[model samples]
Target chain A: MTSDLIAGTPAATGEGPQEMRSRSELTAKEVLREVGSVLRMSEKEASELTSSPVENDEEQTMIINMGPQHPSTHGVLRLMLELQGEKVLRCKPIIGYLHTGMEKQAEELSYMQGGTNVTRMDYVSPLNNELVFSLAVEKLLGIDGDIPERATWMRMLLSELNRMSSHLLFMATNGMDMGAVSMMIYGWREREEVLRFFQKVTGLRMNHNFIRPGGLAADLPAGWRDDVLTILEGLPPRLAEYDILMTNQPIWRERLQGVGVITAEEAVALGTSGPILRSTGVAWDLRRDLPYLKYKEVEFDVIVGSYGDSFDRYAIRLNEIRESMKIVYQILDKMPSGDYRIQDKKVTPPPRARIDESMEALIHHFKIFTEGFKVPEGEVYVGIESPRGEIGCYIVSDGSPKPYRLHMRAPSFVNIQALPHMMRDGLIADAVAVISSIDPVLGEVDR
Target chain B: MSDAVVDSPAPAEQLYGCVVTYSRGEKVIHASRGNYIATLKKAIDDSFTMCTDLTAVDFLIYASTNRQLPSDISGERFEIVLNLISLERRERLRLRVQIAEGEATLPTAFDLFPGTEAMEREVFDMFGIEFEGHPDPSRILMPEDWEGHPLRKDFSVGRIPVQFKGAPS
Candidate 1:
């Protein structure tokens, strides 16, 4: 029964995306298939066989495999490294182990179904993925400027909260990768608070498909204002404590400072973004630089650093968490009240009462479920200040329910390009430190 | 002049019949600056600091022109889009330029905005849109052997089947 059911399913049975995603959801058959793909290094073995070894040399280069399971990679990322003594002569990030084909999957689903696909791409910060995709689709639908102001503001609030939680995981994991296991305890504890806020709003912790095309799933519930305020109020003191515990520590400073530096030019050319790019003194936060939502009305600073190194990335992230805290505070102080999602029934389903009373409302609902709303023939690019960086989605709607072209400009994917440049000419010890600092969530990268 | 191509068409004549439209298909403003992305960028760059996003729209059925722009970047191309955002104004603008494929190669935003470096690479990666002087010209996303630009209108949605093992192996 299970095998037949799995066969009936679409791409979930595919031998990819198991790397970043938990394999528990997959049956034993699925895992075996993915493992086969992982070990299918046909080209590698052929190249290795053709190469001649140093017959009488005093030294030899060693090739190594680093994770799809290793901890330091942040997700199920595998690295092929050629080590000359302690120096890495070359490194290739073997991705697609977590290949969800999110962009492809999104094309099969309607615009309404798109949130489910996007939320899984950058699983850590699903709200961001949802927001950019929805905004782009809505732009294609020509309802972008028509969203209720309150929806836009709340979207910003939740997205900022998402950033805080994601960064806390980074804080925890970076600590663990560096052997500061105690810091992991602190990081998860802090991240849990942000997750609590997420749960209060969206009902799910990790993969909330709450933010959808046209607007959000539901309006801010009762006591959400108080809950958000409390979370915001509580963050600053913890940030200061984390600062003292991590940043000011002499050992932490040494482990991080001046390690894995990428210059501004190189970062841009290689597509490094988020804290990694800001660490080079760019001050180019998408919220400030390219205002979205009510971000223009809110007051915040673009956190920047002088050295584009691991220490700088670490510091910028810490400061950004605090900055996100400030934005949440502002949202509480000035959030407008109205319908959360747009009132456009063509894109958004009408109120439940209308569904019961009006035949047209029932028809709209059925059509939305079956055929989905058709976006006009056009293309749009919408980006947001994801914790990782400028998480943008470029959508092309060819008068179809499914997007013609759906490509995500995942910040983690772009930022990972700088890894080879930063990891070069550095000791093996710096590898973990450098990778941790970039805070790449490969769930997004492979998607 | 191998690298340079020019048409001596009268700028006034080209600008004569151009129309511009915005939200809900309303013409917010219209003015023609002949046929270069630079002209559009110049008209707006004074307000918008960043040429943040650039991509093309394949108006398969909607576009009046039956002639499709060639997917190749080196050839002259149109049916293109350039999105501009102003950090100061808190506004975003999208500029459209519909040119034939061989007439492609819109002016580079690399000079107007430094951030176009990666975006141009993405355009090249998916749509095969090339920036003539792009600093590094290599595939940004797909493997080297990947046959076609996935974002092109013609690429089909291919499927992959799955299988798995449960317990730790």
Candidate 2:
């Protein structure tokens, strides 16, 4: 077996230099090779930066471990940093502290139960995770176009509202990381309003598996429009307060202006999307560029930044909240009244009322809940823009209720790759800012 | 998932010296292990600058039944799925490369898309498919000392032994 072959190899213990190596252990030639390969740069470029040979170095560079437990590292992300006096020479993010083997778990869950599994991956924006998985399953079931108008618009509304709450949380953490302690309270105060609305709608604050495969689990609750309106009405003034507190403050600008900078080419090469990519002046929002659901019908700007620095990323997300508000308002104005889930008997189970009248309805409900509806025997990949970046779902079905294979292309996982390149020349103090700017949820990253 | 029956077969075409098949309206290219990197380079030349995702699927159980592929390419034990998107064209292209169980290795695409570093590591860690030229070819999610490829079908979902009151040992 493959497992035996892998275990049999004596060098199976050769786990590569997973951590950063110290200057004492690496020769000049080896240093050049390691730097060039780790950063994905040419040897010539790497050598030019390390012009002074390793032999003549006065102070030995030190490699230190930063948090799998550091509060500012944002949920158990460990970094192996090689620092010479405060300036970081190399940074390697050591992750998987949160891996519960969700991909393996997905293979055991049915299509109807899969949303509950994926929603927990990115705890901040659970709706988008569920949305992408549902879209992929619907595509495989060949019911992508048959989704009711109300369901599509409802999905859009929930997704946009979740983006707002997610960015609000980022505001809190980013502010806390940057030493603006009061901003954390203010950010959470505003974010609580949004999460309250989510709880009213989805019955949970964080991992709401309300957005199911065919459509939503249930329709909008009573007074949902008013609840959404309350959130919308309450946020603008608080956002303007944020503008005064951080956006225009001199200390805030000074701390983040040029720290952890990345170029447009580098951002694209790093496969970052959403605000990080937009912060590099690449206007690639999957909503505007790809136009899924009712995004095409809505009017909003695809905010982009030219400098690609920490400040650019910060401002991009700050403005994205207002843009999300604009989308939510449009959705409020245009939300169609119809069934929230599809009426396709194959994908959607019989309504609860139907079970009282007919035996077939009870049988269908029991069968659907227990066995789950089967998706076609094909593979499909679906990508949607989450608050962090592009969250993609790839599924292969082998003619069964459970997926043959399920993989989530987590945006935070890829975005964390840019950490090493971003932290290479920055100070150790700025490492927190770099990580906060990337805003990686380690649950998603490790998953 | 559907029952063990083949969907209507579609005609096959070629792109970048590999088979071009569509999976639910998305374009997919079935590249061999030898030309995987070359195909990625060509894709970059054609403006597929951003590699959205790189993942692998273990086909250990579905060796024969319910497998979807073109008539020409034989199904292998492992398939590497690469999803690339062109910002200019706003179109996505998927690349699938097959690897047999005995020789489960392919050249890395890190040179083309540096973002794939972690993803390739993940594929290696989970499915035991080695990328030949990968720099950090170690595990990403799993612990380095882990025993088996957890995602492969052969690797069972393990359980701790349970003790029951009224049962024979």
Candidate 3:
């Protein structure tokens, strides 16, 4: 019973998630103890507890700390929410819990080490972030993505797979937050399959660091194709199961529909991006509209909603999962193999053995490794379509190995700005719906 | 702040050994500061506005390389980058103008684009680049009592100023 409150389970299952066991092992005892301190008090109760009044319920306003520890807040983020009973009056989101100073830290690192730095920004869609940063740098160098047809396809394929995983995680957690018990079970199961695809291709489930400056880290492993195809093939039926279990369900509809509705003008003003912006009747998809990579070759639809409500956000995510899956299927069919890295060894390091044999290779490797290749001094902003929204990297190279300034316009960070606007004078329960609907990752927000 | 920019980066046809690169999600115009805005307007104006960015990068390297370094070097002076984001095109254009290290007087873009009000103030606070005509040109990020521009490449990133944070370093 205590664990259920701690995990926010609406109904009890025989066994908790297996990942929760691993989490218990990884987290420090102090962190777990701190979480326990909060689990002892209900968020609903805490909001009511803060009111300075007699035991009269109507006059008191409650202030609740909605995480930096709780599961549903997504990463280490705390929202100081003011509640007049169950309806939220105001919400002030406190950030910087995950302030790694990734931009400042990137300056200390050379160009080649950029992947290791930026891949952690959007931890869920690491490859997409890595790709955007790399492309911006490469563009500065006047280099194109001339690696291989297959590598580009692989980049697209993995991005779509990652999108599915990201959206599935959102679905699972959003469902759990809204008391849709079975949806969590189904969503997590589907997400696990996508993670398995990442594990096989990049050897890391979350942060692959596979996409690099010139090309991929290396060629895909043998039989990797089969593994991804299997997942893409299996996703549609599972997505349909989710629709039946959650989307079409009347109770799910009631909680989400017409809740926290934002207009297209409001979304633009607040800097909201991704599906949240699209849900507001805006058809601004970076892939179709902006056209990055081989996205021009691949065919897909930009899912838009008439109303920018929680329900529309949910619907867009589902439609995107299907669209992304469709693209993944096409990538598998059209993937052409020739070269993974650029033929110019100056831009890319040679095969591992070339360092031992070739003097030119040795010198090139040393210079590339240490001094790092210089980008011409100028600036270009490349807005790449991430699983979320416009993940753009505006790069200014002073013709140096390290970027002079590294700034990320993260979708989650900008989208989170809309939170207070949507939640003001709304139900306290609606705050969770608004946040979960935004699907923000604190890593990206505070980065 | 109000500024008059004569942005000229050589003759239009003479594309010299200039290699343009983008960095850190900020666009730096990497040309000589003489007539920099006039030239960028010719290049980026019709298709996209060369809106300056949150902060500017003073190419101390380029200034030194070209033997164009300012005589009176102060902590405040650096290059100003125009961070232009296109609403219609959904694109961005970065234009730059270098001011002397000590003297932060440069042409303001508010005359060209009105949305640059917040952006110019940010550059003033972060890099101490004074926009001559920027209305309400004051520190936006740091406190009024704060010393020196915070985002310059020369500005050290370590150590806390006790007076700023209410703690002794």
Candidate 4:
């Protein structure tokens, strides 16, 4: 019957028999006409019908909004998903829900106050944010090499610990997203211990604001070494417990092992960094590649993954916690004894005792506080290997007390671009796994 | 400082006719507005596979007093900065394109490096420098209905006075 329609149609149109008979062929218009005849409709009416190929299917696919407030979306991230049954054909990440205009605000604040501003961007890794900002400011001031050895060591110790804590939060949230509720408790418990150490050292748990342009906000507490040692001792066994809890569990492996796979080429093209890029078998850790803050002096390994899947990303962060612990221990062993901040008089305030005894010291302190020191006119871009990836600060100074322009090359912001690339062709159920695997701190993403 | 100078084989002057390159504290390439795309393509082909950052600095206020660029390169009101890194060589290079105020659009780097798509959009959103060929050239971090570019130097730092509930009306 189909062959009769094909032959009869070509004959009606006066087409060559040899060309028409090459195969059972009909143009889309002819096919529509044939369908029109089958449905007892006129050719004009059939030709007027317009529908997408997907709509022509027996079962139509659906479009769904995942979240600006869904449980599995981590923070305020929203995903607009196009789904065919359970499969996600296309995904668009709708962000900017947490935008606070912090970059614009940084311009009004002085360089001394800049640390406090940037430290809040990636609240999870606040010290890394502060460290990058300080480094950029120092580079603009041309005092990159003048930072005290003790301050450098302290910054390394605090930053690695921050990395550990950030990863621990990821372990917890990632576990919860995958339905392992107990891991939430375990992850937060370990993170609480790290936060306690941070509180003791910098007087704030989350946003320490300790790592400043010249040096740390204050000297470390006398018992900091032992406190960190205690944290170091407690983490290993808990890490082992997590391995037993989720790493080798059958269901965990089933959900993450082959899901959200992205190749190295795609990852780099999308500008994904941190675990997402490392999981794609690239050993590009900025800590090692572009060493800053005495990172070159420390000994540690850059953890990498074989298959760029959700499981590899999870495993890389888990192993990176161990590497960070190694770096922290090395910092403790080689703790330098010197001024924590540079005593340039312009950048740092004079000693408290000297401020009371000497008028010159008192004036220096007053000037440093009321009118912050000016940065030389220039611009510098300094990128550091934060827990998420390359958290960079691009500072353009105008020889004023305040920064001319300060912009953060937020790792979470850049890494989130890889979402649609990773989530394409994956199931809707696996979308949560993919999003959590990216470990996006929306504060950083939106800032 | 003279001993540390490592000259590029294809100098900016030789490769692109109008563009000039300078190293100030770091390697910086100064490209004219018209040759921005070609200069960037050369940098990309020279193994600068990663674009670490792309942003602009509005020199409207600091143009004359604070920064003293060579007279030939100093007059532009806005300078779009591109920081590129070569992963293989562990090296960094900076490209500064002096875009005049009237014609603030430059060719998009999306074709050379897909990563710059978001960064370019950000520059457009904040500094109002349009990328001629950007695929989705829309406000990224800001709301769609935002009024003016916030990062421009002239953008007012709007301050809203706080009002207490029942104290004074």
Which model scores highest in TM-score?
2
- Which is the winner by TM-score between candidate 1 and candidate 2? 2
How big is the positional error of residue B49 in model 1, measured in Å on the Cα after superposition?
12
CAPRI band of model 4? Answer: incorrect
> Across residues A1-447, which tens digit of lDDT does each residue of candidate 4 receive?
234342333322121221111112434443332221212344465566653212333235555788888988878988777677888765667777788789889999999888889999999999999999998888888788999999999999999999999999999999999999999999999999999999999899988789998898899999888999999999999999999999988999999998988888767766778999999998899889988878888889999998999999999999999999999989989998998998888898888999879999999889889999998887778889999999888888878899988989998888887787778778888999999999998999878
Instruction: Tell me, by DockQ, which candidate is best.
Output: 2
Clashing pairs in 4: A67-A78
List the DockQ of the predictions in order. 0.07, 0.36, 0.07, 0.19
- Name the 10 consecutive residues with the lowest summed lDDT in model 4 chain B: B160-169
Q: Please, what are the lDDT tens digits per residue for candidate 3 over residues A100-134?
A: 55766776676788888888999878888988887
lDDT of 1 at B38: 49
TM-score of each: 0.73, 0.93, 0.74, 0.86
Q: For model 1, what is the error of residue A427's alpha carbon versus the real structure, in angstroms, after optimal superposition?
A: 0.8
TM-score of chain A of each: 0.86, 0.94, 0.84, 0.87
Model 2: lDDT of residue B92 = 92
Q: Which ten residues in a row have the lowest lDDT in candidate 2 chain B?
A: B160-169
Which of the CAPRI classes, incorrect, acceptable, medium or high, describes model 1?
incorrect
lDDT of 2 by residue, A277-314 (tens): 99999999999888889788999999999998899999
> lDDT of each model, Cα atoms only?
0.69, 0.87, 0.68, 0.80
TM-score of chain B of each: 0.61, 0.85, 0.58, 0.79
